[model samples]
Target: MKVIVIATAMFLAGAASVQAADKVTFQMDWLPGGDKAAIFVCLERGFCEDAGLDVSLETGRGSSESLTKLATGSSDIGNADIGALMAARVTENLPVTAVMSYYNQGPHAFFTLRGNGIEKFADVKGKHLVTSPFTSSNVYLPLVLNDNGLTMDDITLTKTDPGALNPMLVTGRTDAVISWITDVTRYTRQVEDAGREMIVLPWADAGLVMYSGTIVASDKFLAERPDVARRFVAALLESVKYMRENPQDAAQAVNDAVPELDHPTAMGSLQDAIGLIFNEVTERDGLGAFEPERLKATWDRVAAAQGLDADALDPESVVNRNFMPEN
Candidate 1:
């Protein structure tokens, strides 16, 4: 009787272990794109499954909603922009931490028509521009304009959805749009199909560098499931490496998952976006670990625009390096 009871206890323990490894959810800030290099590759290659994570990828309305979901534990993990996260932390005591930053480039920028005779930033002084209502138009865009001897006063800034941008530009409803470079690439194709052309000015040109698509988790998750977080980051880093090695295949995977992104367009946009991915952090400090200098640069740009003290923000509080893989 004693031997039979011990056998039953061992069986239950094994079952519980398997159940524990069966689930995870990854919320994306947007539908799958080249920007989602690591996460998309991991899903396509089975790295997450092999790591014992049954992952689900859900779309977020935007970064703000994604981080909210993560903070409230509605999702296990999600991508966020460091800039948005910092602003939130200042206003609300957001209970979230960035485990890794995927895009070294923040992916925000201005776009223009090729034949507008406006090759230089100075020409934007009197142009019509499109931007999202929620983002840093009043804050960050001014810095770019000021840097070029222009300001919001210099141009007509139009608030529009990304879907409306292409039509607005093509129809002359707006002169240009401030948007993601990938989105610019999509618009580029639409314009080309309509016998027009566009130019992409990366955020790097204006000195407002930031990390986009950071992996974030709830504070509760960090405290309760450290091991699982570590595994997720490790698998993500592996996915990044895989995507870099197989850019064409990775692009195809993204196209397959996001059917709205037709094949040729997806391939071109992926090729354009690959340049924005920074391998520097992964090669030097390892993935997901916090870097103070980069954080400081981000804050400095924000301070220039918002008149906030750069030193007032605590970089360490927003980033947690404990879960990153040790080299």
Candidate 2:
């Protein structure tokens, strides 16, 4: 199997020689970093080339922003939170659909410095917490708080800017900050720079289990250029598999493409991110394949967290699995 994968990668690496590539613009959910390594690996390692795709990377502010771009046909495909897609689909009737399951588990978590009072999810009670107002994690904050036997009133919460969340945590301006676990390495380095240790309390550990990052495409992009979408997904899936097996190479790909991003931090971020993509849920459902029960479960959680009517939209309608490689 290993030999077959290597041969396939090698074969794809040489594919750009055979044909004219299809240009596909890939919108990002956030700035380039280690957690975003799969796309970089796909581009840097020539997986996109092998699949006859010319993928262009675009920076985005948040999932909702990216989804808006995708729905409006400003972008072809991109990564966004599936829950955001779910809620957006129900309320706004956005013409965007999730094409692949990238992070099978929720990436929301609380980051706090060691000396601070927060040591566990329950420890957050009576503490002041900060989060970027635009993050999709904010929608589920109440559910997580309620699950830990607390409520929004139990903790003093502040909506800080994304760039300031970590600096404030390291400076002790707030007891903790809500961010995705994918930022673990980047945040850990920052905390170390401030001469303080950091501790992370994952919300999933506190009973918030659901899908998070996923590959979504514009409805028109999928409808008008089905073959191009198929090729991009194939390349992306291969890139994801290769990234998991070679974190160092994956990190290097991110750094080599984005020169300002240091290699060590990128490597650490990729390692932390791999935990989200390849885990117990992935073990049961396989890569890029969304299981029916889990789909229902994710929608149930998203609906409960965002206070949406579950009956308004079918969970399956938000995703289309026809592009998963026919193994």
Candidate 3:
């Protein structure tokens, strides 16, 4: 009789423990690819499970769409551009906040053929530029041009589908295409296949410095499940550290998670992604840490571009550092 009672109590406790694992629906800022290997690494390695989270990932179309899902509470957490999130907050009064910054330097860039005679920023004048309406780079295009003594009037802007940008550029339909630097491998391969050499001009080099690829959560989620949020952040940071140490293995993990992803392309993308993930700022402050001054600068740029008052919204209101893991 005593043994039976003990066994029953143990079984109940085990069931309760299983039930207590928090379910986290994570949404990416864009389609799944090599750039998203860290999330897959954490999921496949059981890091999220170890942290008491049962996490799932969903592909997103763009930062604005991802932020919209988060703001509407349709998704628990998302990876998006901090600038886009700030714009949404200012423009729409969304109740979402960025908890972790993975990309200290934004990946936004403009790519063109080396033979296009566009060796410098000034060379872009009167050139036809192709970009998707929803790309983060497009959001900052005005600011990037203005900082370089140019404006929208100086260039020909062609809004097209994201898939068409690469094809249009390779076929000589456009002079340049704006996209994230992580896609350099994809774009480079296409340009090379078309017998052209690609030249990349990152926004950071053009003086449009900002944060990209941030982990965000809706205000409701943070307010109600702060513990789960911290655990998720810790697991994510752990995966990031793991990827930094073993990039090849991280790439393999992503390929394993998404079989359709090409290994070589994924590896190339991961290599480019690592450059943006860890920088002098990340080394000094720690992973996922955001400098207040940097955040303020980003806010100012976004406000200037979007025609919003910089003082209308506080940076602290958009960023919540409480969920970052303790080093």
Tens-digit per-residue lDDT, 259-300, candidate 3? 898788788899889878888878876788888888888888
TM-score of each: 0.86, 0.91, 0.92
lDDT of 2 at 228: 93
- TM-score top scorer: 3
Write one digit per residue (lDDT tens) for candidate 2, span 1-327.
999999999888767455478889999998999999999999999999889888899999889899999999889999999999999999999999999999988899999998788878999999999999878788899988888899999999999788999998988889999998888988998899888999999888898878889999999999999999999999999999999988899999999999999999888888888988998888888998889888888999889987888898799999999877887
Candidate number with the higher TM-score (1 or 2): 2
Question: How high is the lDDT of residue 327 in model 2?
Answer: 78
Q: How much is the lDDT of residue 122 in candidate 1?
A: 71
Instruction: State the lDDT at 151 in candidate 1.
Output: 67
Error of 3 at 124 (Å): 1.1
- Residue 187's lDDT within candidate 2 is 91
Write the number of the candidate with greater lDDT, choosing between 1 and 2: 2
lDDT of 2 at 190: 89
- lDDT string for model 1 (3-117, tens) is 9999999999978867877467888877777667567778778788678877888888788898899888888888877777877777787998888776666677777788865
lDDT computed for candidate 3: 0.87
- The global C-alpha lDDT for each of the candidates, from Candidate 1 onward, is 0.75, 0.91, 0.87
Better of 2 and 3 by lDDT: 2
Candidate 2 residue-pair clash tally: 0
Candidate 1, after superposition: displacement of residue 322 in Å? 1.9
Sequence-dependent TM-score of model 2: 0.91
